[model samples]
Target: MTTSTTPAVKSSEDIVGQKYDRCLADLLVKAGVGFGAGIVASVVLFRRRTWPVALATGFGAGAAYADCDRAFNPARIPGVRVLEKKD
Candidate 1:
């Protein structure tokens, strides 16, 4: 008698969830960096007196970074095209 071994495969939902988690983590890091940058810039340029403006600027920067990052990332599966024969 022989025993068979098979690897466990992840479901589509699980795979998608993992991808979403990674994207969320990346966005969080980007937001933190943007906030820090805004704080530094505000202090250096405005003598640390523009709290409201700095907060808004940081939020906008973070959102823009996330949008661009999502747009530029390529899909896991590449597209395939079939060639036509010449008549």
Candidate 2:
């Protein structure tokens, strides 16, 4: 007798949850970096103004949102082809 091995399949909810977690992490990291950069810029070039910090943070968050959108919807990505499975 021979045994057949098959990989475990993840439910849709699990996949979505994982993606959400990843997006959240990315957003945090990017925003943190942007905040730091903004701090440096404010001290070095902006006369310690507060607007740069907010603007940079917003930019980072927007970028993260765009990246998350692309991740959730692959069709939005350019130059990508979606192929159907043939069985």
Candidate 3:
């Protein structure tokens, strides 16, 4: 039987880059969950029907808006560092 040797692998940067992108995607999923939860809590607060309720509603709205912004915003991912290790 004849044997042939395989060529050496090229630079792994591409592979690592792909993995990094995938990890960022995972982080996005988690952030989305948090943002969604905040929105739900905000809605619940809005339903209370009083000044105190209104206060809570405002607080909740603030938190929900912040979280939603984080979830939808791709810019914040760097702060969370989903691909720090890969880089």
Candidate 4:
């Protein structure tokens, strides 16, 4: 009896789609955290709350976080090179 082994191969489209999905999910999580923080801050600072202000703050925070993440974690951002230190 012989066992047949087949290797799994991923197409370019599938790989790109997966990467896109992961990036989107990461952004969503970051945005959610920012939104929650903005809401909490708004509540603490003012007796009244507004959706526009909260949303603006949330998006700003999310963008900032994404930028920082990409800058610090080069592995996450494709084509970005990380410099290594020489001993």
Candidate 5:
């Protein structure tokens, strides 16, 4: 997800906004591809063995979760932290 600091928004409000956007639904279906580029790029740039590996693993896992959501919607993991905004 992206982060922005807008004074008008509260901490919780930010999460709500993301949730309102169907964060999970949107993230899913990319087959760990949408964000894969970022992971690879970061790893290549920093070249930090520990951090790079960790990020790589995280990206891989996230991609898997997203892919799973596509095949079978990821059951609400709970505490999604998304604010789930109201229209």
Candidate 6:
């Protein structure tokens, strides 16, 4: 009696779900940092304005989105080359 040797396969849904979770976590962390920075800048530099906080938070979210896009589509990243073997 020989034991079967087969690798477990992950479904596409699982892969997509994992990626989504990662991106969400990244967005939340980056945006939170930006918000904190904005609060400090607003208090010290902008006469306690609200726009700075909003702008900084937006920037953080945008950066996260860009990163997620690149992850989902590596070809969109600049200056990367893929070498193929000539058989």
Query: Against the unseen true structure, what C-alpha lDDT does each candidate score?
Result: 0.67, 0.94, 0.58, 0.70, 0.56, 0.93
Residue 50 lDDT, candidate 5, scale 0-100 = 58
Residue 65, model 3: lDDT of 54
Model 2, runs deviating above 4 Å: 1-7, 81-87
- Candidate 6 local lDDT, 1-87, one digit each (tens): 999889889999999898999899999999999999999999999999999999999999999999999888887899987779999
Candidate 5 segments whose C-alpha is farther than 4 A from its true place: 1-48, 74-87
Candidate 5 contains a number of clashing pairs equal to: 3
What are the TM-scores, per candidate, against the unseen true structure?
0.53, 0.82, 0.37, 0.54, 0.31, 0.81
Question: Model 5, 1-87: lDDT tens per residue?
Answer: 989967674587676665645545545534355446546766688664456555655675677665545444334554554466899
Residue-wise lDDT of candidate 4 within 18-42, one digit each (tens)?
7667767766777777677777767
Model 5: per-residue Cα lDDT at residue 37:
53
Q: Which ten residues in a row have the lowest lDDT in candidate 1?
A: 69-78
**Residue pairs in collision within model 4:** none
Q: Which regions of candidate 1 fall more than 4 Å away from where they truly are?
A: 1-5, 49-87
Full candidate order by lDDT, most accurate first: 2, 6, 4, 1, 3, 5
lDDT winner, 1 or 4? 4
Question: Which 10-residue window in model 2 sums to the lowest lDDT?
Answer: 51-60
Q: What's the true lDDT of residue 42 in model 5?
A: 62
Clashing pairs in 1: none
